[model samples]
Structures are given as structure tokens and as C-alpha cells.
Target: MGNDGQSVGDRRGGLAYYELEFADDGAVARDTGLRAAVTAGQVDDVFVFCHGWNNGADSARRLYTTMVDLLADGLARHTPDKGARTAVTGVFWPSLLFPEDDPTTGRPASAPRPTGGELAAGLEPAFPGNKDNLARIGVLLDDKGGSDRLAEFHERAKKLLTTPNLDAGEDSGERAAAELPTETVITYYSGWSRVDGQAAPGLADPVEGLWEGAREVLRTLSYYEMKNRAGQVGRGGLGPFLSTLATPDGCRPREHLLGHSFGARLVAYALSGLADGLVDGASPVKSLFLIQGAFSHFSFNDVLPFDPGRGGALSCYRNRVDGPLLSTFSAHDRAAGWWYPLASMLKRQDASSQADLLYRWGAMGADGYQVDTASRVRLAEEGFPYGFTTGGFYRLDANSVISTLQSPFSGAHSDICHPEVAWAAMAAADLAGEHQRPAR
Candidate 1:
């Protein structure tokens, strides 16, 4: 591509790749890749990465590169070799919604609006059928009205849909000219429809239904319930992403996942949404590294998705947090610790405080983050204390090189790709160890 503030590099045959493209002035772009070399017989462990909020492909790539570099480096330093080289895969979900303030890039970040819509619509056919299905439909309907003025879409789609009749014994120009062009109309449809002219209807009921549906598929503290929310696959991008990331050369082992604020909610959902393997059986998760997660707001019922009074439903019921996930790392950062939960008190009509509304979601007080003290106590009584993992390298020692120290406004959300945070993940992966080929 053009080198006007853009950089690109790839391995000889595209095995490893990296690219950096600027979306606007002063906004840096970074992209990197590590292709999987795992053959069916040679496959060892797989790591599929999912990134957090406000990140684009370039940023995700850079994060992944940093993760791979950190992994390779960490492995050499920490644990003993299991005589296997871990493969890494980077899962790039559409992140076009990342904010863009530059006058230069105009609507560059707005590019993914259409694709995001299409992805949402793909789930519409499954709506109201299953709780998860309905939630997806609702999410799709929620974003239906976004403006995308891409003019060339119709012509381009028409061209792609046309195919020649190759079996014809002789080529006929008139026949080709008379052929009707196949056209597929991709319309944007948000999950919400007017409630007698109102845009959002059944909001409370749908949300309640989602929660109830979710309880059927999850266990308290298990990964399944965490990933599903209000009966929908709440983690947004990654649920669809894993299917693409697990192909033969799709991903590697020990890839990194980073999320911020609501993004962290999605990550938690991804972790707990496993229905077939994770909730119903043993989870397929090998390791997870979470930072400044929004978990405190989530209840035990939210995480586990199941009533513990019912015994041993899912086989992967090990409660000790040793292997599958790393202990969550967090700081007393202000946004996560303070500001986020304080916004619930703001009146909806207060334009000045509009931005703060979401902060009240899981926060502390009335019309705010806090659940009532009585309810809090009740939730505690119903809490899954056995859910959390206590084992982990609690502190990043001097001997360790990964750093996640936050700046004044920095908290779990912005720490996703912070050099130190990335390094922390590297350290978590034990990437500094020896690598050996798997035995034949």
C-alpha cells in the first residue's frame, strides 16, 4: 500500500505479518500477525485473541505483535518447557466504532458501520427462537438506523452475484445479455422496532427474559454465564470471531485478549457464554488474563448462570482458579473504582451529564450503580464465593519486566494495550520458556 504514514511488512509467504496505517494525523496505526502452522496431527495448544473496546485492526495487530513478542520472551524466562511450541492466532473483529476526532480522516472510522450491520442482521433469522437468538436479534435491531452512504455498494454487489453459465455448449452474447443479474439487498435493521411509534419497547421485559434464559445455560461462577447476558451473546464481537480464528492457519496458542469498561463486560460474557462445551461440559478455555474487570458489579448468578443447588451438571466444575484462567488484576483506578459507578444519579435531561449515564449501570447508588444494601446483602448471600481463583502471581516483581501502571485517567479500560499491560499478559503466558516441537 501507499507509504504515506503507513507501514507494512509480511513474512516471505505471509506467515507472519505486520502493518501500520494512520487513520488520521497523529493517530498511529499498528497491525501484526502470527499464522498458525498446526497440522491436524501436529496440533498442540491453540490461543485465539480477542481485543477490547476502541481498538481497530491496526491497534489489535500491534497488541498481538507485542503479545507474541512478550510471549516468546516470557516463555524463555518462566516455566519449564513442555516440549511444545505454542501457536498464536489473532482474531480481528470489526472495531470501526472507535471514536475519531480528526478533521482529516473525516469518516474513516465510520467504515465498519455497514459491515457491523450485516453481522447483526445475520442473526436476525434466528430471532425470538432461542433466548440467545432473540438477544442477538435485539442487538441487531438496536443498531439498525445507522447512516451508511456508501454509493458503490449496489453496483459492486450486483457484479459479484453474477455468474456465467459455463456448461453451455456454445457462448452466446445475446444469452449473456438477456441473463438477469442477481442482486442481494443488504439493509440495516436494528433489533428494536417502534413501540407504537416509540423506538425502544419491551426493554425491561426483554432484558428480564434474557436473564432468565441465560440462567438455563449457565452455572454460578462458571464461564458460560459470564459470556452470556440478558439471553444474548453479550461479548459482541468474539462469539462470531472464534469460528473464524480456529481454522488450520487461523490462530496460535497463548494469544492476548484486552477489553475496557463495557468491553470488559463483553470479555466476561465471552468467558461465561460457553453453552455446549463450557457450561454444559468442561470449558475449552485454557487461560485468561483479566485486568480491572467490571466483575464486582456482576453477581454470582451472572457468572455461573446456574443454580448451584443442582449438583454437577457441567463436567468442568473445578472451582480452584489454577489452570483455565489467571487471577484478575486491577488497581484502585478512579474510573473503575469511582467515577463509573457515580453517574446513575444524573437526570436524563441533563445534557452536561449525558456522557456519565452509563457509569451508573453497575455503580453504587440510587438510579445508580449500587444495588440496595438489602439486595446487596441478599446477593452476597447468594454469591458464589467458590467461583473466584485465588492463585496467581499477585504482584509484578522487579524480576518481571511487564508493566501495567496507569496514568491519572488510566484504568482497566485503557490498559488493554498499554505497554506494561501487554507485558503483563506476556508474563502471564510464561512465554519466556523453551520451545520444543511436539513428539510425532
Candidate 2:
């Protein structure tokens, strides 16, 4: 019941809850007590939940609490005994919120552009080390500068959110974006504004929309930063912590990881870190349920469906989960459906068609796991059977329940606090428990 990094004994909805705070660089906060509590065998099962970008510490807590409460309710109705020893670990990390479209119409808001101070204030926290760069960009925005100044602003913004060499995945689109000419980048940004959340025609003149285009470019850069940070935190902090839990004298509870948006990328990268020899023993992760994952759909694929010569970044880490690896996708999630693809690509003509290009750079949340090995299933109600008996990849079409239009920019992206989703997580955990039990 304490503040983010200070809380370790919080309890909610008849279940023990712990906050595990991590820095952007993937360092765990001191004295969080998650490790000690788990090692003490306080719980037999741990549901580790991580939030994606656009969430503060408080919002993340609310999300975890709400989802965990739903899970608790499901358990009470279905399997009462299992709820007694279960615990929830909510992961809090640094992420920033992007400007959103009108919730009612799903179109760009008509609000005036943010002033220099406003821009700086809004972005300073997310780019902590680049305060000066953010301030400069803000000044440039306010000045309505010429092409030279616009180029400078873009350079500063890009540097502010540049991906670290260690955390850079196999994202050719991202690389292409970084290498694009300033004018082409502006053109892409202008095109994004017209196509963001509406079926609008492309912009008539990219230069005319330079100011808005610059802001859009900034948002894209922030997205890239958040993506990189997710991987960094997962690999450096969460993965090492999980390794500790897997130690001989450690707790070794059946761990079920549930992450939403970029948080899904976090958990997936945690497995990557573990697979890269961070831990010598077998993985402690029993089940992984990625809700509206914000990473590449081909993350678990051995080779890209369109390009056989290349494979996903996390392909080798797919089997790290001892039980099932499930991901949810919804067509209504505009953040994943629209913005994700736009931010991912620089070239508008990369593929044979627009659909092909989107598929090439699509997010897991919008497109699901794009691999031949993944089995597709519907997101069922509480009492329905999931039949997740064995360990493998499964993509759940959550459009039935995750179809609510919460916001224009991120339609139903954050509408995952539903009972059906909770049931799915619990079902996955139950299957993982079955796998962990000694066989006759």
C-alpha cells in the first residue's frame, strides 16, 4: 500500500501483491522484497504482470490490481484452493505517454500545438538524460523554424531516443528510418498524420504539414525509445531476477508472466536474456501470456514468412517458457494497428502492397504471432475450455472482448482488464501448474 518503489507488502483482492520497480537501464530497485518473499515460499505461484508504455507508476498499479482482482474472482468461482497461495508481482518501469487522438471520433485532436515549455515538460521524464535535447526541440517547435532548424530538431530528437547497440533487435525498418533523408522522414510523418486513426487520404503537400509532422516524428522516436527500454529492463533486470528465483535454494515457484503492450516485449526479451546464458539452470517461467504485445509478430518465428533469409530477434528464446506461450491480438487496437506500423517503417514502398508492408512491420498485438507453428484460438469466456495442455505457441484472437473503442489512438489497446482476459491468464497458469507437477 506504499508508493511504487517502496511497496512490497501490498495485498489486494484476497491475494498478496508486490511491486517490483526497475530503472530504464534494467536495474531493479533495492529492498523491493519480491525476491525475499518468493524465496520464503510465501506463495506457490507468482503471476508477474508488466505494463507497457504510456503508463505511470500509479496507473500500472491500478492495472495490476484490476487484472489480479479479476483473476482472483475467476479462481474463487472455478478453483478456490489455488487462489490461496497465489501472488501478483506488478512491474513498474519508466515509460511515457504519447499525444492521443480524440476518444470519441478517433481523429487527431484540434488542440493547438504544445508550446516549447509544454513540450519540454511533457518529454523530460521519458528522456531523462536528454533534457537539453528535448528543450532544444521544444524551442525549435515554438519557433516554427525553417528546414535547417527542422533538420536540427529531428537530429536532436533522434539522438534523444536512439536505441542502444546492445538492445537493437533485427528491425530493418527502424534502421531504415534512422538513415532516411530529412525530407523523406518529414514526408512519412505527414503521411502518418493523415492515416493515423482514420481512413483519410494522404497529405497533399508534406511540407505544408511540417510543424505537425515534426511532432509526429518526435512521437515515433519516443516509441522507439520505449521499445528499447522494454528490452533493456527485461534483459538486465527481470531476467536476472528470475534466474535467482530458479536457483537451488531459491523459491522456484511456478512463474506465469503476463505483459501488455511493450511489456510483452519485456517478458519476451527476459527469455532472450535467460537463453543467452544469464542462468545455467532450467527456466523458471511456466507460462507467458502477452496481451496486445507491442513488439514484432514474427518474434518467435525461426524465419520471416516474407523473407526466408531473416528470422525474428527472439526466435531462439521461444521455448524458454516451460508451458504455453500465448499472445492476444485485436483488430481494434489502433495503436498497434496503425501507429505501430507507421513508427516501425520509414519506406512507404517497401513491399508489393500496403498490406504486405504492414505485415512486414506489424506488432504482435495487431497481427498475432506470424509463424507457422502458432495455433490460433479465440478468447473464450470464463467457463470455456482452453485445452492448453502442452507447451507451445498460441495466438488468441481477442477481438470478441477486446473490441471496445477506449481511445481513438489506442482503440481497445488498454481495454484488457476484462474478465475474459483474466480467465485466459488463469487458465494458462493452471496448465503451467499441471506441467510442473510430478507425473506418475
Candidate 3:
């Protein structure tokens, strides 16, 4: 609600402009020696941003520009001086992509590995109950390829959990398979920072060093901010950034967090860490805005050990047309045309694409043609306004988005920032009511 947009960063503890390319070992920022850099304003509000995979510093800058533009517009209507704050910080993690072979010059580096599509495929199976499929985890656990580590993991988990009681019936192969380790398994990415080929046998780290680095940075940043302020230090990203919300002249009093795709997964890890006391908890997050989430194994029916905190909040916005949880599906977006590829790998499901799964389910309605109707419905139901209900899933239409536009980041992944569509989706997610699944 604070004004002074233009003058916000000009004051003490002013906005810190940084462009850093993060790597497993550490990060390289445009402004070297942040320890020495000083701003004029007392930092008030903080917004910590996490970028998705395959993105460079420049791409993050562009995203920052879009967010700034939208924020400016929103501020013009509400705050007296156009709504500005003291500090805005961004964390840029490295996203290594396969080099591409250029057609024009026949350059080998121009030919990059199929990163986008791969990422989308990895994220698809996280959305269960799509296509009325009950538990789509079978796809990922299928291990049809015979040699994928994912398949092996599921197989092992199934064996450990479904061995039958001491006096139980014969060991039916069906029963062994049915006992998939969907529960009691937590995704572990430790030691992912080792060089790509160095990790060895089974596990290949996804988002490798990103999460670890984020944790270290958040801890360091928060400690630096609250050296003197009591009950202000934090460990998780959002919590640490919140510690910087006051004292700086241009700093505002409120903050917003926005995450997409694998970024959402990292956020979840941060939150989980906080709940488990692995991360410091001097301050807690106000809200979480998730976009195109790419988690594969989490289920709403199950109880998550996470704590909502005294003032924590959650909101999700998924694109019905998004191929996988990661990116678009069409030929134009060959790389991410399916639900986040990695999600599929992690969830251990098999679907040609997330869109195929949705089309098979009755959720899409007219939009079902090229849409992953079921996946979106699951995302909207379990994650959007809130978790899924017992009787049926929750459904949101265009109207729901309109109602929430006033406060959110104001955009949708499927629409790719199309103002009208983004606005509608936000409104739908913001609408209040227990929505039953619509008839197919």
C-alpha cells in the first residue's frame, strides 16, 4: 500500500540491481562484491524470485521487466505515489542446456539437447486422477524402457511397502505391483552438485545445484538482514526475504512470491525444510503463488507434514492447455509440449503427453481437444484455491480469474501473459465456493 514508486529505490537501502549466473559451486553476479555495495534506503518489503530451467540471466531480466511493468500498472490504481518499495532481489540459478547444431552454419553447438520437452515430460505424472485414471503413477513406474532409474526406484519402493502381513495371502505379482511406493517416499536430491558424470550409478540430480545454492543464499541473506532485528531472521527463501521488509526507506511492508515449473518444486523443498526445522524459521512466508507446478509424487489425499504457520498462505494457477506441467504442448514448443518431462520421470507415469491424459478425461469440455484437461483439473482442485474435496474435484471458469486479478501477479502460463486470459484465470482461482466437478 505504500506509494513513492519512483523514489522508493532512491532512498536508503535502495533496490539492489543484480544479474548473476548461478552454478553448482556458487554464483557469478554482475555487481561483484555485494558485501561492499551499499544502498541509501532502509529495506522495507522484499520479493524473492526463482526462475525455471534452461533460462539465462538475460531471460530472467526480461521476466523482471514484465513483472515490473505489471506491478507499475497495478500500483498506479491503488497507492498514492504509484506503489513502490525499497528493494527488489532476484536469484538466478544456472540451467545448463544441450548445445544445438545450427542449420544455417552447420554448427554443432547450435544443436542442443531436447531440454524443454524433456522437462515437461518429467513433470506430467505428478497430476494424478487425470483422465479418471485413478492413480496415473503406473505410467512412470511402468519402466517400459527397461533401464531407466525411475523404473527401478518404483520397483524397489513397491517391494518395500507391499510385502503383505506375516499371515497374509500368497505373493501375487499383481499385489507387489499394486503396492507402488507412492507414499512413504520423499524425493531426495542430495549431492546433485557433483559434476554431471560424477554422481555415479542410480540417481541423476534434477535442477542439480540450484536448490542447495538457494538454501545457502537464503540463509546468508537473512542473517545479514536481521543481524539486529529480533524475530526477523529466516532460512527459507521467502522467509529470509521477508526479514528485509522494513528499516530501508524505500522498502515497502508487503511482499509477493511467484514461482513456475521446477521452481515450484524448489519452493516446496524450502517450505518443507522450514516445517522440519532444517531451515531457520525466524519469519514465515505470507503467501505462495505457484505457476505450472512440476511436482510428481505429492498427493492431496495424503497428509503433508508441512506447517501453514501463523500467517502462511497458498495459491496455484495452472494452464488447462499446458502440455505437461512445464511448458506448451504443440509442435511450436517441441521441448516442453508435454507436462514437465522430468515430472513424468519422477512420478513414474507413462503418457505420450499431458494433453493426451487430459483429453481422455472429461474435464476439458470443448477445450479438451488439445488440452490436458484432467491434469489441469487435478492441479486446480488440489492446489488452486485449496486442496481437493472428497465428493469431487474443484472447478474454476473464466469468472474466477477476474475476481482475483486485483492482487495477484496477474497472468497464467497457458496464456503466456495474455492480459485477458491471465486476468480470468486469477479471478477463477480467487472465487470463493466449494465447486463440484462439472459433468463431462
Question: Could you say which candidate leads in lDDT?
Answer: 2
Instruction: Give stretches of model 1 more than 4 Å off.
Output: 1-43, 79-84, 95-263, 279-281, 294-296, 299-324, 327-332, 345-413, 416-440
| Model 2 spans > 4 angstroms off | 2-8, 99-113, 165-172, 194-208, 246-251, 275-281, 348-350, 431-440
The model with the greater lDDT, 1 or 2, is 2
Residue-level lDDT of model 1, residues 1-440, one tens digit each, is 12322222232122233332221111223333322233232224444454433334565666666655544444444532521445444543322221221122334432532233343333233122334533443343333322131112222212211222211111111121122221111211112232112343235555433322222111111111112221123223343233233435534233334343433444434443333343211333434444444433323121221223322111122221123233233333444444333322222222245334332133111111121221111111111121222222132221122124343223333444443543444433333232212110
lDDT of 2 by residue, 89-162 (tens): 88888877764432433344565434665766677887777887788888887877679987897788778655
TM-scores vs. true structure, each candidate: 0.40, 0.89, 0.39
* Residue-level error in angstroms, candidate 1, position 182: 46
Pick the winner on lDDT between candidates 2 and 3.
Answer: 2
* C-alpha local distance difference test of each model: 0.31, 0.75, 0.28
lDDT at residue 400 of model 1 (Cα atoms): 21
Give the winner by TM-score: 1 or 2: 2
Candidate with top TM-score is: 2
User: lDDT rank, highest first?
Assistant: 2, 1, 3
